[model samples]
Target: MNKFIVVTGGTKGIGLAILQKFAQQGFDVATCSRSQKDLDTLKSELEKQHSCNVIVVKADMSKRNDIKVFSDAVIKLNRPVDVLVNNAGYFAQGQICTEPEGTLENTMEANVYSAYYMTRELVSLMKKNKKGHIFNMCSVASIKAYPSGASYGISKFALLGFSKVLREELKKYGIRVTAVMPGATRTASWEKSDLPEDRFMKSEDIADLVYASHALSDKSVVEEIVIRPQLGDI
Candidate 1:
């Protein structure tokens, strides 16, 4: 059977990079996003470029029902997903005290809650096969505190911890979990920040890392990989 991968936020940025890599390798790619138009366009572009099967679903990861629907669609398309990448997330910029009342909660819902829901649903599918790989797209903020980023950073921190605990819990099932912490990727979202694009890491770099890490023998796994721009110190 062909390898299958399910990626959240797979239409753009780091998620898009990962999806392209897998598609180029001929993996059956299934991805979800909140925009149907973007998903359809992405599906066509990727399918044309890679000549691989692509499944696109409109889903808001923050909604539990949407998460369940997306997961069910993926499983129905491919019985066993060889890999799951939780890359859908939101970045809310502001101080906790000054931001909107529910900003932090919304950030947590996107970054933390979505990861929990995706993993919960996919892990059950993996359990049936006793094998799978999961990659959580964490951030450098997951490790350090930054000014005016209380909510976003905290959410990533929660996801980092979740990834670690899950690695330990799912070890017995032969399912590998990896937390990919990337620093300063030059995505459209980063344009709002003051970071210089030329000097920072790119989404393709993270995509390459994902492919390489998953290529390792089943006996070993890299639980966490923290990547940073060589010019930037974290």
Candidate 2:
């Protein structure tokens, strides 16, 4: 069977870059996002460009029900997943004391709970097959404290913690887990900033690293990957 990958929030940014990269390498891919229109468009473009089967689903990862909805669709595929990239996430700038109420809650629902619940559903297939890789899209905020980075930082830190625990738990099963901490990526999240584009890392750069990490022989795995802009964090 062809290699299969599932990347969440593939409508744009690093997720989109990942989808394009893997599709070009002949991996049949699946992805989900909040917007059906965008998903449909991505499906068409990747299918046309790479001629690989593309599965698209409309899913708001922040919601548990939607995570199941997307997971069920993948389970129904009846094929073992070769890779899973938990890329869907939320980001907002705020101070813990002054940030809007529920900021931490909402961000956790997106960046942490979604991956937790989604991974719960799919790891079984990997266990059955005895091989798979999972990538959690963490952030530099996970390790550094910055002004106005409250909720997003907390959520990413929790995500990194989750990834570490998962790495330990799944190691015996031959399922590799990687926590990806990226800094100042030039995605929609940074579009509002006035900083020069060169200051941030390209989404494709992360994508390349993610795919490369998975391409290693099954005997080895990269536990964590930290990427930053050439000029450093913005």
User: lDDT per model, in order?
Assistant: 0.90, 0.94
Off by over 4 Å in 1: 193-195
RMSD (CA, Å), candidate 2 to true, equals: 0.7
What is the model-wide C-alpha lDDT for candidate 1? 0.90
Best by TM-score: 2
Which candidate has the top score in lDDT? 2
After TM-score superposition, what is the CA distance of residue 105 in candidate 2 from its true location, in Å?
Answer: 0.5
Q: Over the stretch 1-234, how does candidate 1's per-residue lDDT look in tens digits? A: 668999999999999999999989889899999999999999999988987889999999999999999988986764788999999997778987798899888998888899999999889889899999999999989998886688999899999999999999999999999999988888877777675566788799999999999989999999999999989742
Predicted candidate 2 versus true structure: per-residue lDDT over 57-95, tens digit per residue: 999999999999999999999999999999999789899
Using Cα atoms with residue i matched to residue i, what is each candidate's TM-score against the true structure? Answer: 0.96, 0.99
